[model samples]
Target: MKPLLLLDVDGVLNPMSRPTPDFHRYRCTVGAEVYTVHLNPRHGRRLIDLALATGSELVWATTWEEHANEWIAPRIGLPSLPVIPMRPGEPSEHGEMFKTRHVADYVGGRPFVWFDDQVWAEDEEYLRVHQGLADFLLIHVDPGRGLTSRHLGMAHEWLTLTGFSQGS
Candidate 1:
């Protein structure tokens, strides 16, 4: 089975920081709320390349959910991809981020790499204890810096080392 490349929007793609030259600022409207998003167009190409090289599927694992495909993906040149359903404002039963359990359920024993700002040690422990879960790498992106090339390199290294690459 192909490994999953799970992405989050707020802190992963749309960084919560001062705009840099590499980032373009845009106003995104989700329902009645207007949100300012900073996106780096080059990230789309890099993520696509990583997925192709590693034989993984890109998936949205953000609270933005379906809105990510509509507002964020096109802006970054990413194609519409699968979204992991998230219940916004719902507290997690396990004391980890609410997305933790849902992510485990969504992967269903498939190896995955998740990029998110809110993931913590508790989240990692939750996934580790989850039954029927395959190996996963949870990358904690700094909300201030967003997704950097270093993070991508780490993911690439992990996937290749874990035998989740196409060459494997």
Candidate 2:
């Protein structure tokens, strides 16, 4: 199966603290209701380049769903990307569990790389239990810095472990 690279919006890509560092958030009107929206990789070209280079498919594993591409992608100089909405009926749990479970569902027997700062307690346990998900990588980033070469190295390690790396 082709590998899915699952990315989170708020803390992983955009970040809660930055105004669109790698990611960003804002309030906007959607239809009749006002909603807080987020944008990521304010500079997404490099990220997009990296993903394409790695032969990994990108999926928005965030609460933003389709909005991620709609409100966010253009600013970053890229087109829309596929989205993986949060778990249905899961209620608002911590960001990590929500991401973990949802990503597990999103990948659905495929391999994936999960990039987010919120991969909490349940995430570790779930990863521990599901060894086949070993092909799955849980990449954590500091909300302040976004994805860095260090994080990319981790991703590279994971990709290598899973035999997905295209070596130089």
Candidate 3:
């Protein structure tokens, strides 16, 4: 099976920092809440290239859930991707981030690479113990910086080492 590329919206794609020339500010309304997100349009192409090289499928694992496809994807030039159902503000039993349990369940035994600003040491240990032999990489993106070429490079390196490359 192809590996999964899990993406988080708030910190991984839409940075909280001030916008750069390459980043565009978009005002999105989800229900009654309006969110202003800074997105780099080029990130879409970069992510798609990474997935193609690694033979991975991009999946959304964020609080935005279905709204990511509606708001974030189009702004960044990405096609609709599958979203991992998220229960915002719900606490995890393992004391890790709220998304940890849900992410574990969603990937099953498939290898995956997850990019999120909230990833902690506890989450890594929990997944290491629970995921068994399934290889996984958790990239901690700084919310101030968002996704960068370095982050993409790290993912590519990991996928290649794990034999998840398209040429594998």
Backbone clash pairs for candidate 1 read none
Candidate 1 lDDT over residue span 82-122, tens digit each: 99998767777677998998899899989999999999999
Per-model lDDT: 0.92, 0.66, 0.90
Model 1 residue-pair collision total: 0
Encode model 3's per-residue lDDT on 43-142: one tens digit a residue: 9999999999889999999999999999999999899999999886876767689898889889998889999999999999889888453889999999
**Which pairs, if any, clash in model 3?**
none
Better of 2 and 3 by lDDT: 3
**Candidate 2 deviant stretches above 4 angstroms:** 18-27, 31-42, 88-96, 130-134, 166-168
Using TM-score as the measure, name the better of candidate 1 and candidate 3.
1
Q: How would you encode candidate 2's per-residue C-alpha lDDT over 46-109 as one tens digit per residue? A: 6666566667777788877887777666766667888886755675443337556666656777
Full-model lDDT, candidate 1:
0.92
Cα lDDT, model 2, residue 25: 57
TM-score of each predicted structure versus truth: 0.96, 0.75, 0.95
> Number of the top candidate by lDDT?
1
Residue 24, candidate 1: Cα error in Å is 0.7
Off by over 4 Å in 1: none
